[model samples]
Target: MPVLSGAEPFAHDGSEDIGVLLCHGFTSTPQSMRAWGEHLAAEGCTVRCPRLPGHGTRWQDLNQTAWRDWYDTVDAEFDELRGRCRSVFVFGQSMGGTLALRLAQQHPDIAGIVLVNPSVTTLRRAARLLPVLCRVVPAASGITGDIAKPDGFELAYDRLPLRAMASLQQLWRVVRGELGQVRQPLLLFRSNTDHVVEPVNSAIVLDEVRSSDLTEVVLTDSFHVATLDHDAPTVFSGSVEFLQRIHRERAEEVV
Candidate 1:
């Protein structure tokens, strides 16, 4: 399948000492994360952002994919980064955050993790009907492009695929159950007024994760897609700082 014009996956080989794996949200393309990846690369960090399966092509294609497919893609990228760099970090936006957490849980060597408006659970009442709706409804209104900036946009599908979302919910359950296994340093960015994911999602992550190094920055100006919104610089800069701090700490421990 041909990727959308701006949705192709991107990579930057900046340094062998540090690598960052970026993951975009469900139904969204790598375009949403390209700028952030470039920022990390500018800071001398090797960066990679992979296009998740069933994304950046057609919404219907997502229906044929499961959450495991998305996780597998990022997992492979993480392994490749780990092989190339002395230390590796994982950054994720939305469902991508869920995958990041799962990676940390599964891989004890992840240097750290960063998240933007990650979704672990939703308060939407309609979600209760997904089990049945996915059987009858193929798609619903998309929850994309929630940027507060006037010109900011995410390359995402306009329709939400039911089966894919159902698979995502299953992934949430698995991640939440294994939160205690995620002990890596963590930084999370949450939008104060997100239209897609609620604040409770971040709260759940901070509360449940076993990471002793935890930080949260509230985004006052952005919505769900803070990585592309007015507070994008905050997300980008803060992530770089977090990576530096974690790398320093790891170096000290090694010394």
Candidate 2:
């Protein structure tokens, strides 16, 4: 059992061949993924949710980080999982999902991907004014309006980081360009009332990916943060089933 460092803010008991590495969305902490990781761990799998750079701390801390640093954080976590598990699965929420997609493209060791309200594409209106808005906006918190936060978690800031938003736009551009290359099995969850990523992003994944096996669940009862919302149990059970099926298939292949 490899002990994860608190600097990463992850909870892992041991190394298991079947491992799941979870990434939380931008402006969020691994705490968001903690419940799902615990649920999965109870089902006899090793699970980890690592805090990305600039997360689990102050919002200004994130403003200093770039996409590469964020990606590298997840990448290191993925590498650790690869070392311990015979097969690995990756999942993420919102911006984290964007990182998962990038990882799935590059890591053949990854067996599957689960995306929860992933921000595959930037907000539509923002996409048009990305260049100017990114510069115009200042580093602050990311929460706004009546955004219902996950229980017990406070957003690092109340305003969005302009440069980080710009980086997201750029990351989406990269993911969009490489969409066809993501051939891993996929499980996509999207909220019907999501105020963030557009619905069409999930539709794009359903349409463009060449993967023969894909499943999508529409969370009718939740808002953007479905993993921690009313439909969270559904999210947990469905994801565990998906991971189990993939694990079984791999086990049979080895036999």
Candidate 3:
């Protein structure tokens, strides 16, 4: 399948010994994380943002994919980054965050993790019916472009593939169950007024993750897609600062 023009995956090999793997959300493409990846690259961090298995092509393609397929893509990228850098970090937005957490659970050596409005569970009554609804319906209304900035937009599918969504729910259950295994340093950026993901999602993560170093920043000016919204600068800069602090602490430990 031909990748979309702007949704293509991207990579940067930096001079620094830090590697960062970025993951975009469900039904979204690497385009959502492109700016953030570039920012990290400019800061001398090696960066890789891979297009998720079913994303960036068409909505129908997603229906044929499962959560494992998406994880395999990022998992391979993480291995590549680990092989090339002295330290590595994982950054994710929305469902991307769920994948990041799964990575941390499986790889104890990940330097740290950064998440933006990560979703592990939803309070929607309809979600309970995904297992059955997905079998009957092929797709549903899209949950994209939830940005507070009028001009901000994500290059994502306009429709939600039901089977893919059901798979995502399965992924959420697995991640939430293993949250205690995530022991790396963590930074989470959450929107104060997100229309897509509810506040309970972040609350559940903070409470369940066993990470000793956990920090959360609330974005008052953005919605679900905070990466491309008004507080994007805050998300970008704060992530850099968090990464630097983790790197510095590791260096001091080696001294």
Candidate 4:
């Protein structure tokens, strides 16, 4: 089933003609993408960073939801952005990137994508063991340490919901298999020092996409959460450049 363009479920009455929709990684909230969204907004792009169905408020909330719910939330947010802007782009981090891949596949109108450490491919053997592990392990938090912030502040959400991880695995399977279905331009930024998701996952994405226009950036100084790492400024600048290039192309198309 495809997510068609229409009125957004959420209200965005004061935005400009260009919109960018952002999604956060698993066990994380919209706060992870808040700065990215705001920066895009400051550049005159209408940004929508919605809390995935079971995120932001509590960890247990994730266990109650599945990947479909997460995709639906992003889909509706995309619709909202579409309603207000002439052009829209989808960007995400980690599991959020998986959802964004689904969006790019189904929503052909999307201008392009900026994927930051997208978890399209899980760690070795974990993808194989997910089915049994999810059922055996009860809902609990697995995120081990405090997510290091951009300002050197630490805000940690120390809860690992097995069900949520399971759902994410399911999404990964779907997106991983459907990578060739994505034909839009793509930008991939990866951290070589990422402690969570393996760097090879980015390699998998670049290898699978059928899109002829693709750019990749390696973040050597960052960790798993590249958005707030030492190279965060580079991530921001690169994304903005990608958006600007796409925006310019759209302008040329219009003229």
> Each candidate: what lDDT?
0.94, 0.78, 0.95, 0.77
Ordered list by lDDT, greatest first: 3, 1, 2, 4
TM-score of 4: 0.88
Q: Write the per-residue lDDT of candidate 4 for residues 48-73, one digit (tens) a residue.
A: 88777766555667778899999999
Model 1: pairs clashing at backbone N, Cα or C within 3 Å: none
Worst 10 residues of 4 by lDDT: 1-10
Minimal lDDT window, size 10, model 3? 11-20
| Tens-place lDDT digits, model 2, residues 10-66 | 657554768898988877777667788888888877777877877666556666778
**Candidate with better TM-score, 2 vs 3:** 3
Error of 1 at 140 (Å): 0.5
Runs in model 2 lying further than 4 Å from the true structure: 1-8, 139-156
lDDT string for model 3 (21-140, tens) is 999999999999999999999899999999998899999999999999999999999999999998899999999999999999999999999999999999999999999999999999
Candidate 1 whole-model C-alpha lDDT, 0 to 1: 0.94
- Backbone collision count in every prediction? 0, 3, 0, 5
How far residue 65's Cα lies from its native spot in candidate 3, in Å, is 0.5
TM-score of each: 0.99, 0.90, 0.99, 0.88
Q: What is the lDDT of candidate 3?
A: 0.95
- Candidate 3 regions exceeding 4 Å error are none
